[model samples]
Target: MTEIIDGNAVASQIRDDLTAAIETLADAGARPGLATVLMGDDPASQTYVNMKQRDCEEVGIESHHVDVDGDASPAELYDAIADLNEDPDVHGYIVQAPVPDHVDYREVIRRVDPIKDVDGFHPENVGRLVAGDARFRPCTPHGIQKLLETAGVEPEGKDVTIVGRSDIVGKPLANLLIQKAEDGNATVTVCHSRTDDLGAKTRSADIVVAAVGVPELIDGSMIGEGAVVIDVGVNRVDVSERRSEDSQTASDQSDTEKGYELVGDVEFESAKEKASAITPVPGGVGPMTRAMLLYNTVKAASLQEDVAVDLP
Candidate 1:
């Protein structure tokens, strides 16, 4: 029987664990605050920000939001970042990605105070992560480590193949798994689009993380027997197109009222058959990512407020 890792359960526990620390901070009159700065009106990004705000409210973290016009000048966005940096009420904040192309995302990240960079994308944070003295680990990668721990799938000496090289997931994850920590010490291979024979790499690993953003790129034949599979991609496919591709049944199509269905990089049914454990597209890594962001915000508040609190 294959174990289906429940990210919702794990994330809920993490939130519950943080409640004590949050209360401790509250007692000190330094309740954690997290802010989201959205530059454009991209529907997906807006939805994500909304969900994050709800998570903050659920955990007793004060939530704040700022919106910039889609056609706003880069300077206008920079002003918002500057204000967030100076706001004592905001212990941590993130400028939602996909800012207008005219705005250099890297420059925007650099402008954020490293101490309040809860997203862990700032150059200083990235450098600290690589140096093994990380102040903040990128949320997704850290969440992956937590999931592996909860699933009883230790990565200490296992081969981990991460199928993406984006800084957000791949680069940070590889750095993390190879570190000299309990969740670290894994032998990691980072694969990209140019990599030849991707299947061979995935098939040989004890754990495979599919994050390439391509829907159903990794299938059952590509996964090693008894290996752990973590799917991090959430892609929307038209129900009709998916049905035509034989990826969905008529009943499955009927369940989707939005004309589209969510899928991961790994083909779930096929990969589940060969895997010892696997995370589902909608219920796996997504919740963990949001949960970790809250974790970072709490940590940021603790550090800035000089309050020591236990973290999960």
Candidate 2:
């Protein structure tokens, strides 16, 4: 029987484990706090920030938000980041992605204090990660590692084929996986759109991670039997034309809010058949990102406030 990796269940257990550390921080009079800075009104960005705030509330982390106009000057945004760095109340913070086109996003990352860069995008934190002495791992890649651990699928000595080269997910994950550490020691191959014969690489891998933004890119034939599959893409695909006449007899298709539905880079219907374990799109990697953010905030508080708390 194929096992479905349940990220929601795994994330819930992590939250439970974190509650004890949170209590410890509270006892020391140092409740962890996380802040997010937004520069635009992108719907997706707004939704993401709102979810983070909600997660912070549930996890006992004080949440703060700063909204900058989409047209704001780069200096204005830079000042906000600097203020967060000096604020005693905020242990960590993230500047939401897709800042104004005029702003140098990379510069924004460089300006953030490495110690408070909970997102781990700053060059200093990224450098530490590459050196195998990371102060803070980026949340998505870090969350993916935790998910693999929870599923009893260690990367040590395994062949991992990651299908993306973006700095956020692909590059960092590849670096971490190839390191000589607990979640490390894996042989990793990073592939991008330019990579030729992608299937040949995936078929040889013990684990396949699909992170490219394309929807339903990898199918069962590309995956070797008994391999673990992790889908990290979240794309909304238009399924209106594909709807079958018999799909939903009771519901009116016209009444649907949108014509699109969520999908991942891997074709789940086909990949699950040959995989030993796999994660679903909406409930899989999505929850782990938020969970790790909370985890990082707590850890940051422990280090900055000199509060001793046992973290898992």
Best by lDDT: 1
TM-scores of all predicted structures: 0.97, 0.96
lDDT of 1 by residue, 1-312 (tens): 999999999999999999999999999999999999998899999999999999999999999999999898999999999999999999999999888889999999999999999999999999999999999999999999999999998899999999999999999999999999988999999999999999999999999999999999999999999999999999998776656646666668675567888999999999999999999989999999999999999999999999999999
> Candidate 2's residue-wise lDDT over 65-122, tens digit each?
9999999899899989989999999999999998878999999999998888898899
The C-alpha lDDT values of all candidates are: 0.96, 0.91
> Which number leads on TM-score?
1
The local distance difference test score of model 1 is 0.96
Give me candidate 2's TM-score against the actual structure. 0.96
Go through the candidates in order and give the C-alpha RMSD of each one to the true structure.
1.5, 1.6
Off by over 4 Å in 2: 248-255
